[model samples]
Each structure stands twice: as C-alpha cells, then as structure tokens.
Target chain A: MHTLHVELGERSYPIYIGRDLLNDPQLLGAHLTGSQVVVVTNETVSPLYLDRLLAILGERALVTEVILPDGEQFKNLETLNQIFDRMMHDRHNRSTTMIALGGGVVGDITGFAAACYQRGVNFIQVPTTLLSQVDSSVGGKTAVNHPLGKNMIGAFYQPQAVLIDINTLHTLSPREFAAGLAEVVKYGLICDLPFYRWLQEQTPRLLAREEAALAEAIERSCSSKAAVVAADEREGALRAILNLGHTFGHAIETAQGYGKWLHGEAVAVGMLMAMELSARRGWIEPAEVVAFRDLLRVINLPVAPPADMTPGQYLDLMGRDKKVIDGRLRLVLLRGMGEACIVDDATEEELVSLLETFR
Target chain B: MHTLHVELGERSYPIYIGRDLLNDPQLLGAHLTGSQVVVVTNETVSPLYLDRLLAILGERALVTEVILPDGEQFKNLETLNQIFDRMMHDRHNRSTTMIALGGGVVGDITGFAAACYQRGVNFIQVPTTLLSQVDSSVGGKTAVNHPLGKNMIGAFYQPQAVLIDINTLHTLSPREFAAGLAEVVKYGLICDLPFYRWLQEQTPRLLAREEAALAEAIERSCSSKAAVVAADEREGALRAILNLGHTFGHAIETAQGYGKWLHGEAVAVGMLMAMELSARRGWIEPAEVVAFRDLLRVINLPVAPPADMTPGQYLDLMGRDKKVIDGRLRLVLLRGMGEACIVDDATEEELVSLLETFR
Candidate 1:
C-alpha cells in the first residue's frame, strides 16, 4: 500500500492506494472518528462493491446507506437533497460520518453533501474507478453540476481521508479506464514532461491494467495534484492551470447534458481543442498537437469534439465557465508541449478561428 | 457610525452599525473587491430598502436582485435553491458578490448562498432588523433550516462586511422589534450582567425605538457575538455557549412551525426555560427566573414554551439539534444572570420536572 498526504493544515488527510484496500479494516477504520456512518454509493457501484466495504466497516459504527442512481445526470440539487433527506432521516448529527463509495460523480456529490451536512462532517472518499482515484479523490474539490456550468454550485471542502482500492479498476470498462487517462495526460502536459514520455512509453501496460504501471500513474498524478493544491487550494492562480482542458470540457458536459458524454471523454476532446489553440498561437509545434492527439487516440479516448457545436455555441457555453475571471474567459492553454498557462487574452475572433479550423 | 471588526484570521470582517449607513457608499464600496454583485432580499424588505441599497451600489457593478418570500418557514433548502437558480440564470460567477438585504432569515440564507455559490463568493450582510444586526450579522454562521431543525442546512461563511442601517428598523412591526430584543437580552444573560440590567431598564426606550438605546444595544450585542465567534468560528466548544437558548429554541421553532413565532420570540421563551432549568438544578436562585420572566414579558416576548408540545416532543426535537454532541444534548443554561454554562448532565427526570412545573 502507498500513502500520500495532502498537506492542508489541520484538514489534511491521507490517500491510501493499493489492491483490495477496501477490505483492509485498518486503513478504513483509522480515519473515521464517529460512530454513525452513512455510506453513499450509486446503484452501479453499490451492486459491485458495497458489500466489501460494509464488511470492512464491520460493527465499528451504525452504518446507513443512501444509494443514488448511477450517472452524471443524477448529479443535481434534487439528488443532493436526497442525501440530506437520508441524513435527516437517519438522525445523523454533526459528529456522524459519511463515506463516498463510487467514482467521481458519487464522490463529488457525497463530498459536497458532507461539506453542507450539519455545516460539515467527516467524509472519507472510497474511489473505485481510475478517474476518481487519480483526480477527484485526492483534491477536496467537491461539487455537483449546474445546467449553466459544471461544478457551479459547490464548496472547496476537504475530506477526512481518501481510501483508494486500485483493484476496483478491474471492474471498469475499457472506455472508462481511458477516460481517466485524459486527466493523467493532463498532468504531463501541464507540469511533467517526463511523465508524458512515461505515459507514451507505458501505453500498453496502462491499457492492460498492469499493477505496477497503474499504481505508478495514480501516485504520480496524485503527487502532482497534491503539490498544486497545496500551493493554491482554492485555485487562486497556479491551480487554474490544472484545469488545462476543463473550461471547454465542462462546457461540453453542460451543453451535451451531463450523462451523454463521460467527463473524461469530453475532456479528451477539450484537451485537443486546447492543443489546437496553442498550435494556432505558435506556442507549440503543429507536430506536437498531432502527437498528443495520436497518444489520446491510441489510449482509446475521444480525440474529436462533438460535431454539432458551432463556434457560437462553444463561445456562449465556455464564456459561462467558472474559470472566467472578472467576466473574462480564462482558459488553460499550452505555452509548449509540457507547459500550460492561464490565457485570458484570447479574443472571440481567435477562438472562432481555432474552432473553424478544428471543425 | 460604529465599526466593530470580527477578528477571524483571514475571514475577519467589519460590522458598520448606525442609522442610515446603507446610503453610505464608501462604507459598502470599500469592502467589495469585485464589480459584479447580487442583492438577495425578502419580499418584505425589498419594498422598504432594496432600492436604497441598489442606489448605494450606484453603477459600481452590474447588480442583480433575487427577491424571496419573507419568514423563517421560507428558510429552507427549496427556497435556498431559488437563490442558486437566479445566480445561474443571471450568469453570475465566482467573482460576483452577494448582499443580503433583510433580517436574520435573509442574512442566514444569503450567507449560505454566497458560501455555496461557485464554492464561495464575497457577500455583505445588510441587516435591517435589530436581531440580524446584533447577532447574525456579526457571526459568520449562515444556514437555512430543515424541517427537522432550525438552521440545519447551511455553512459557516463570513461576509466581506456587514452593513447595518438602523433606520430600516423603523419599518419593523412592534412584535418584530420585541422579537429582536429577545436575542439582545440573551447576550446580556450569557455574559454581560450590566447589559442584562440595561435591557431590563431600557425596554421602554427599545420599544419606543430611541436611536441612542437601539444603537448601543446593537453595538453591545454584536461585540459579544463577535468575541464568541472569533474564538470558536465553527462551534467547536466556546461557540456552543452562544447557543444558550438555541437547542430548546430550535425545538420550539421546528415544532410550532417556523414563522408562527419569530426566532427571537421562540428564543425568548427558550431562555426562560433555561433559567427555569437552572433554578431547578440549583445553579441559580429562583429570584433570577422571576426577574428574567418579568423582563421578557415587559418586552412583549413569550416566557412560556408551546402548550401543544409535551416534554417528549421537546426532548425529541431538542435531541435533533446541531448542539447535540455524540447523541448527548448539551444545553446552554444560566449559572446566573450574565453567566452561562454548557450542561450535559441534566437528566430526563429533571427536564420533565421543569417542563411540568412550567406547564
């Protein structure tokens, strides 16, 4: 097992990564301080892994279950209310604990639920999928999607701990696994060129879900995320670069309706858009864009954005993204193949030019 | 104008207490960091003072308004969502600021909204009524009530500044004015013996809306609230003492239906119950109870719990209050006038005795 600490003062918690750690009683038990626990999982994850986690929890606390529907579409105020309803129904107090047991959607919603439940509660993230384990699980960025923008209504709440059982990746569909790689590739593009090279070289091992390579990817991705989050936990300046493709990607998710395209799939296309924009501005060579696109394609991630969006549609949607500072659209665009920077200087005309080329 | 600073490390804000300060743009403008603002008010306060506040904002930023229905009954998640819906509808982003333009219900709801909107946004509390200016305005405790308890669903979010316009208090009905005095009296009973005596002597002046007495009352109450909040912003321990009558008060509000009795009115009766409990426990002399009850009666505040609720109902409801620690009800009962202490050792037998005697 590998343990990484997110250094957030008193709210700092550990991310425990290993095979079958969900069944490891010590890792799960060490963090929970309260006797009342609510395990929030989705229908899909509940069917697969709930029993394993429940067994690990044993008789440590009075555990209740709030099983939400599986998908991004269910991430809304209504679903969030359901969690609160359960919390109130179970008579859970401020000292009660909540465990999030699913991928990013479940984790995001549950984390926000914990953040708001009785002002705040101790929440542990038990991320099952690669997307959540590598990205959402480590960062305390918990939010649900709004119709206008993704994660528009949320809080920057840290969890008590994150328990990652990378063994759960065995259950992920191939498409789902690749969806998580988009964020992994994002780390390489933003801050770690060496990791990008490593990703390129280890594509076969990552695709095969080899233990060592997958573990390395998850750890490296988390380390980079933790370092950035530690520097700017609230995304003041440097952390905005982490949203390398998220502004366009969140727009894609918002415009298409949440459940239609997986978050990573949208991000994959969005990263390509970012790369294309970078190349247009002569920040990176055109060949780097091709190579990046090829790597994404090789990993079975979507390389092309949805064909239906007009530059006007993209403009309208992206303009409303959370990254817009003082009403200016601040996007994370590449300065070079391995360096990303927040670019707010791009005009609508420039965006249209890039969109026209892409289409 | 009297400006009292809440001494939280990074979250500290100033409370500007005086008559007609809402018209002072410099007071409001100096605290605001962004050019986008959203003013959230109730239907009750909108017709009275919303325009004056918007005028003070004065083309400084793009201002949007969300006018909600008034009353504690409306302080719920559904109504809170209306604020979010307007925020999304207006395309307000993280940098957009929110000004709460009403009493405690408005301040609590808007503060929670600002806390949750895009994780958080800068908010200002423009408290019109005496209660909010004295209590909610100084403390960063913001919440919307749940059906189960009062202020159950919310966050501990501070504002950029609190703008108090005592002139707006003239618009309050006599019953509402007295309701606000209930919390004012609580500050006196909790920690300030001199203020408690002042409240008793100045009830007539307070009821008459004498500017000098009202301003002094607001300033003194705010100072007490600020001191407690600065010490324990998240209600770890010391802050719980400020919730002296609240555990019982929350029960009364939840049981009798919100808006039936204003928060301070419910708290007025709850405070008497605490005194009665203190007397029964031999913590204070019986003379203190009679003196406390007389002052409340003179101020037009209730000194009795609801005749409809049994002791069991009170117990059931109080048990669900946020002040309950590890399933134990920790109540703020008086050690004597202006000296409050948290008591967890009160037996059900003693509570039943006190409830029966009061009944």
Candidate 2:
C-alpha cells in the first residue's frame, strides 16, 4: 500500500493505491462523514463492484446507489441531473456523503454532483479505470460536458479522499487499458523524465496489468497531478501545466462527440500535436517528438487524429475551448520533452498549417 | 456613495451602495477583467437599465446580453443553461466577464452561471431592486432552486464587485419595495438591535422612498451581511445565523411555488415563526416576537404563513433544507431579540404544534 497526500492545506486528503485495498475498512471508512451515503457509479461498474463496496460500508451507513449509464456521452447536465434527482428524491442533505465509484466519467460527474448539490457536500473518489486512478481522481477537477465543449461547466471542488483498488483494472477491456496509458505517459512527458525512461522500459509489465508496475505508475501520476494542483489549485497559472495536451484533446473529444473516443485516447493524439507544435517552436528536438509518437504507437494508442478531421474543423473546435482568452486560443504546448507551458501567440494560419500536416 | 468590503482575502471586492450610480463607469469598469463582456439581465430590467449600462460599458470591450424571463420561477437549471448556451454559441471563453443586471433572482442565477461557466468567470453584480442591493449582491451565495427546495443547487462564488444602483428601486412595485424592506428589517433582527431601532424611526421615510433613508438602510444592511459573510464564507458555523428566517422562508417560497410570494414576503412571515420558536425555547420574551411581527407589518410584509399550509407540510419541506445534518433538521433560531444560534434538538411534534398555532 502507498499513501500520497495532496497537500492542499485544509482541503487536503490522501490517495490510497494498492491491490484489494477496497476491502480495507479504515481507508474507505475514514472519509465517510455522515450516516447517509450515496454511491454514484455507472451501469457497467455497478454490476462489478457495487456489492463489494456496500458490504465494505456494512450496516453502519444508510447507503443508496445511483447507477448512471456508462459512457462519456452521458457526461452532460441531463445525466448529472439524474444524480441530483435521486439525491433530492431521497432527501440527501449537506451532511450526506457521496461516493463516486467508477471510471473518469463517473468520477467527473459524481464529483460535480457533489459540488452543486446543496452548494457543496463531502464526496470520495474510488476511481476504477487506469485513466481515472492516475489522473482525474487525484485532482479535484469535477465537471460535466457542455455540447459546445468538454468540461465547459464544472467546479474546482476537491473531495474528502480518493481510494483506488488496482484489482478493478483487471476488468478493463484491452482498448480501454491502452487508452489509460496516454495520460500515464503524459505525466512523464510533462515533468518526470526519469519516469518517462522508466515507463519506456516498463511497457510490457504495465500492459500485462502487473500489480507492482501499475501501482507505481498510478502513484507517480497522482503525485505529479497533486503537486501541480496544490501549487495553483485554481489553474491560475502553474496548474495549467497539468492540462498539457487538454486543449487539443478537448477539441478531439468534442468533435468526435464525447464517448466516441475515450478521453485518454484523444489526449494521446493531442500530445502528439503538442509535441509537433513544440518542435515548430524550436523548443523540443524532432527526435523527441518522433520517440513520443513511437512510444504511444508501441502501447497501441492512436498517435494521430482521424484522417477525416479537417484543419478547419479542428480550428473551429479549438476556438470554443475554455482556455481561449479574448478570442485567442491558449494551448498547453510542450516546451521540451519534460516541460509544458501555455502559449497563446500562435496565429490561426500557423495552427491550421500544423493541423494540416497532423491530419 | 457608500463602500463596504466583503473581506475574503484575495477573493474580496467592494460593494458600491448608492443611488444613480449605474452610470459610473469607473465603478463598473474597474471590476471587469477581459474585453469580452456579457450582461445577464431579465426582461423586466433590460428596458429599464440595460441600455444605460451598455452605454457606460462603452466601446472598450465587446459586449453581449442574455436577457432572461423575469421572476424566481425562472431561477432553475433550465434557465441557467440559457446563459451557458448563449455564451457558448457566441464563443465566449474564460476571459469573458459576466455582469448580472437586476434583482436577487437575476443576481443569483447570473452569479451561479458565472461560477459554473468554464469553472467560473469574472462577474459583477449590478443589483437593481432594493432587496438585491441590500442583500443578495453583498454575499457570495449564488444559486438556483431545485423543485424540492429553494437554492438546492448553487455555489458560494464571490463576484468581482457588486454595483448597486438605488435608482432602480423607483420602478419597483409597492409590494416589491416592501419585500426588500423585509430583508432590511432582518439584518436588524439577527444582529444589530440599534439598526432595528433605526429602522423603526425611519419607517415613514423608508416607506416614502426618501433617498437618504433608503440609502442608509441599504448600506447598513449590506455592512451587516458582509461582516457575517466575511466571518464564515462557506457557512460552516457563524454564517448559519445569517439564514435567520430562511429555513421557514424557503419552505414558504417552495410551497407557494417560486415567484408567487416574493422571497422577502415569505421571509417576513418566516422571521415571525423563528421569533416564536425562539420564545418557545425560552431564549427570548414572547413580547419580542409580537414586536418583530409588528415591525414587519408596519413595513407591509406578511407576518403569517399562508392559511392553506399545514405544519406537516412545513416539516416535510424544512427537512429538505441544506441545514439538516445526519437526518436532523438544524435551524437558525434566535438566542434573543438581536442574537441568533443554530439548534437541532427541537422535536417534530413540538414544531407541528407550533406550526398549528401559526397557521
């Protein structure tokens, strides 16, 4: 078991990573504030792990479950309202604790529900998918998607604690597992060069879902995300670094119509475009960009956008991104192989030309 | 002009309280962060003051307006989406500033919209009504109502600045002006006894809409609310006192349906109920309750619940309030005539019997 604390002063909580840790009563129980609990999971995840958690929670708390449809397409206000509907119908109040138990889609929506329900309530994240375990669960960026853009409506609300069970990763389909690796690799690209090299060597073990390697990756990724979140908290500046490939990634997610492409899959191709932009900026080595793409491909992740998506479509989509300031698109481009910074100076013609080559 | 700062560290901003101050561009413009500005007002207020604001905002920033329906019935997620839809459709991004123009309902919905739109944007509160200028515009409590309870979904998102124009109150209906005074009287009841006496002395001037008395009332009310909000931003403990009659008041509003009985009118009756509860608890003299009711009556505010509402209905509704903890209904009851504290030990039977008397 590894315990990593997200040092956010009064808002801080620990991320517990290990196998079969879900059965650990102290860890999951410590975060539960009041007797009334609502476990927010999706349809798919509920069938697999809901009973186990219910048993773990025991007869102590009056527990209820809201099982939503399992997909990013359901990650909108309408679906979010379902969670609220259940909560209000059951009369959940400020003291009631919400438990989000599923992948990124579940965690994101559930976290958002917790944020808005009664202005705010305590919630815990038990992220199952590798993408969520390592990334979304650790940072408190809870949101639902707007049709205009991904995560267009949300809050920077933190949770009481996040408990991860590596055992759930065994249920992930091959494609889903591969998608999670994109964000995993992102941590190494943004800040940890040694972790990048380590990941290059640990691909086989990571792919096999080997417990030790998977745990290490999740911990390191969460640690990186926690540090960035702690520094900025509100993404005023430094925290935007954690959004390394999100500008282009959100564009892909929105264009493809969320749930068509997994968040991590879109992030993978977005990272590639960012690297290309970094190369164009004369900051990153061409060899580094090629290597990054090669690593993604080797891990069975898509390294390019769909062939049909035009530069104009990408431009139109990116213009709606939340990071845009005063009509200028602010992108999280790579400074070098292990550094990322926000750049808003790129012209439309330059971005369109780069998108042309990528497509 | 009177300025009262809601001291929330770096999140703090000035509350400018005065008459005919909407045309003061410096007060409104200094708070705006970016060039793209969106003014969120309601139909009732748009024709009255929107053009004046548009003129004051000038050509320095690109401005747009989202004029919504008038009334609290429109203060829901569906209406909130209208703001988001317009902003997204217009390609408004994070740098865009939102200015809320109207009464409490507009300020609240707009503030909550600003809080959620791209995880928040810079927003200024341009409160038009006396109720909003004295109350809602000062505190950072922004929310929209759910069917079950008022303000069930919302955030404690502070605005960049609050610009209150007392001149708009001239257009308010007689009932609307009285509703605003209910909140003004509440400020005196919950904490400043001297202000209560001051309100008593200035009843004629206040009722006549004498500019000096109205301004004084607005400033004093805002200052008291600000001091309380500053002490407890998220309402962990100290801020709950500010709710005073709100629990019963919310039930009245929800029962009657939003916009049927104005918020302040419901609060006036709720304050009487709270005073009765305070007397029942042996904390204050029963005579004080009558005096409080007399004051509200003098201000043309309702001093009793609707004849149709039963105590059982009140119990069912108050149970849904956010103040409930661990399934217990926690209420902000008075410690004395001018002091308030939260109590959760009251029996449902006692409450029902009390409600039977009031009804």
Per-residue CA lDDT of model 1 for A1-359, tens digit only, reads: 99999998987888888888977888888887878899999988998999999988868546789999999999998999999988887788999889999999999999999988889988999999899988888779988887778888889999989888888999998988999999898999999999999999998999999999999999999999999999899989998888988887887888889989999999988899999988989899999889998999899988777888788888998877888778899989999878899988999899998888766
iRMS, candidate 2, in Å: value is 0.7
Best by TM-score: 1
Query: Lowest-lDDT window of 10 residues in candidate 1 chain B?
Result: B55-64
* Residue lDDT tens for model 2, A244-311: 77888888889888899899999999888888988988999999888888889889998888878888
Regions of candidate 1 where Cα sits further than 4 Å from its true position: none
Number of backbone collisions per candidate: 0, 0
Give the TM-score of each candidate: 0.99, 0.98
Reference-based lDDT, residue B197, model 1: 87
